[model samples]
Target chain A: MKIAFTTKGREWQSEMEPRFGRTDYILIYDEDKDTLIIFDNCEAKSHEHGAGPTVAKILIENGVNVLITGNGPGGNAIEVLKKSSIEVYSGAIEMSVKEAYDKYKNKKLPRF
Target chain B: MKIAIASGKGGTGKTTLSVNLASLLAQKNSVFLVDLDVEEPNAKLFLAGELLSEEPKYKMIPKWSEESCTFCQKCVEVCNYHALLGIANEILVFPNLCHSCYACSELCPTQSLPMFAQKMGTARHYVMPDMELIEGELDLGEEQAVSLISQTKTYVDKLLLKDTIAIYDCPPGTSCPVIEAVKDVDFVILVTEPTPFGLNDLKLAVETMRVLKKPFGVVVNRYDAQDDRVFAYCESENIEILAKIPNDKALAVLYSKGALIYHSSKSVKCELEKISCFLKSLTCKERA
Candidate 1:
């Protein structure tokens, strides 16, 4: 699985790689299994004043399969993501990357 | 014209300067004091006001139908965000995970997907005797503060009944929220203190402002007893120094008690008045 995660804040960089607790969003690809591995989108950058669209735009362009993070997306932004195949998990901020990914694997997390 | 007061790091007296400056500006021009720091809105604490109205808003997510889903896995394949989960017999939809692109619905051969709206947050607007205060409160545990701030601005535009100036207290950091608050503004006031952390964050904020192509000046908070490094940096960068508020323990004591420092100290008020004048002149020059 090829997984990419965005750091939440600079301070959490050290802990993010080891446990998946630091980054704001995690994108995972399960190639051989033929199953998509998704985490959450928690990238802290989107919290900026005018950055919702910009961040969502980047995630879609990058081909992120699953974004495990904490953020309630904007209205128009939701439309853009639905078109782009990017899913956002808004209440995943407090959940560690591992926990979020595990839930996705088990189909325990509810859809927004 | 609208002016945003921002600090890169937290606890840098942004609210203090914003409140005083807005009060002073309100004396001559009707000023709208907007608290863009939705996460921790503190401007109303200094200004006396009552809740006027709050409107709830939301973002949309896609709803999928499993009855017609053929398990082609196309939706899953196309979804880079993994918002859709397709099983042999069922397809699950995660609304919080949905960015609302409608790609799944667009790509679905059976057209089994549709969009549904969900609450995002509430923006509160309060009317004070002298000025209006507006705040965007993202629902607790919500992540998209930037969007709420953008919506709040439109609401503010509707409330502008006459010609008035605006003083926006922007959030900390140089990320999306900060950019949204400062964007399209006439000018920005970057507030900082005299410390290593202060200087570092100031640089980040300044870089962000430059990237956004906004005219900005520096205001050194707590200048009476600090090193000259901040001043030196401003001089080298040719960034204009707006005004400096001295570090007064008396003022600090007043602030600790939930009172505005500017009201307790005439010197502080005078300093902010000077800054207000400087800002007006610069804005005039920019307009010319």
Candidate 2:
């Protein structure tokens, strides 16, 4: 399973970004292999409107089955993710991407 | 001649000038006042007239025919707005994101995508004795102000009299809708107040007009003689100060009541007449 975390920076040490759509970076963790991949999320950073669904599409294309972030996604983006059977969890705010992943593994984060 | 009254900041008296000027101009010539501020059209509040006609405006949006669709994602690829998405066995459509560019339908490989009209807003027609007023009112939650403004202008174009002078009360700011309202006009009256915020946005509006290569002049609304910053900037730019309406409490009272100041104040009427005459002179100069 691939889990995505909205982050402030590309590395696992960077703090988890509160925003889902306009986050600067997304850190994807492959639970099976215990590997990590970082996406810059440049389009979300520059989008003036509809950033939520656009970023959601990017996550979906990256085979992300779970999204962990500090804040919630927009209504339309939530709808799209729900339709795609992707689970969204909100928690782990002010913590690093690696820490958030640890909390997710512990099932401490709240699912939306 | 077509003239647009625009302001970079809201509450700067674009509608006040447009309604009064159109009323005054209608006394002598056929006039059409178009309120292009669809998001919050307030020109009708000031004008005393009977509603003649109201028609709903529609814009083309893509409708997918799933039976013929091959799930190739061509339509999704062509949509720049991300309004379309090919997910699994179905295509998802987000109407809010669609720009109605028809590119998706045009790019459909199997001709599976069709176009349909969606209600964007309403175009209203109001009639007074001397002038006709056409206003566009965008529906709540509609994000296609530019398209609706364009539709309103196109609707008025067909009904225009041979020598009718059209005045467009454009929306505030130098956005896409403002550009749609002011584009192709013979002249644009840029209204601004004497303040830092007003001047900053006025500079942006001026740059936009310059890029459009349209002839435009500045109107200093609520002008105070003590404020010299706006005057100094206008002088440095060599932009004509076509009119300066003094900040008066009586005018504010009339505006609050949805009444025209020119109708009750002789001095305001004179000032509006002078501005109208200046616009007429520009028309004559263009003809010559």
lDDT of each: 0.72, 0.88
Worst 10 residues of 1 chain B by lDDT: B85-94
DockQ of 2: 0.39
TM-score of each: 0.69, 0.91
For all candidates, the clash counts are: 45, 0
Per-candidate DockQ values are 0.05, 0.39
lDDT of 2: 0.88
- Top model by lDDT, which number? 2
lDDT by residue for model 2 (A1-112), tens:
9999999998889999999889998888898998889889887678666678777887888889999998889876886787677899997699998899889889999997
lDDT of 1 at B247: 84
Lowest-scoring 10 consecutive residues by lDDT in candidate 2 chain A? A43-52
lDDT of 1 by residue, B1-288 (tens): 888999998988999888878887888889899989988888888888889998997776777776887788788667755566553245656555565577888888988776777787888988888888898887887776777788888888887754588888999999878999999788999999998889999999999999999999998888866588888888999999888888878877877666778777888888888887887797678679
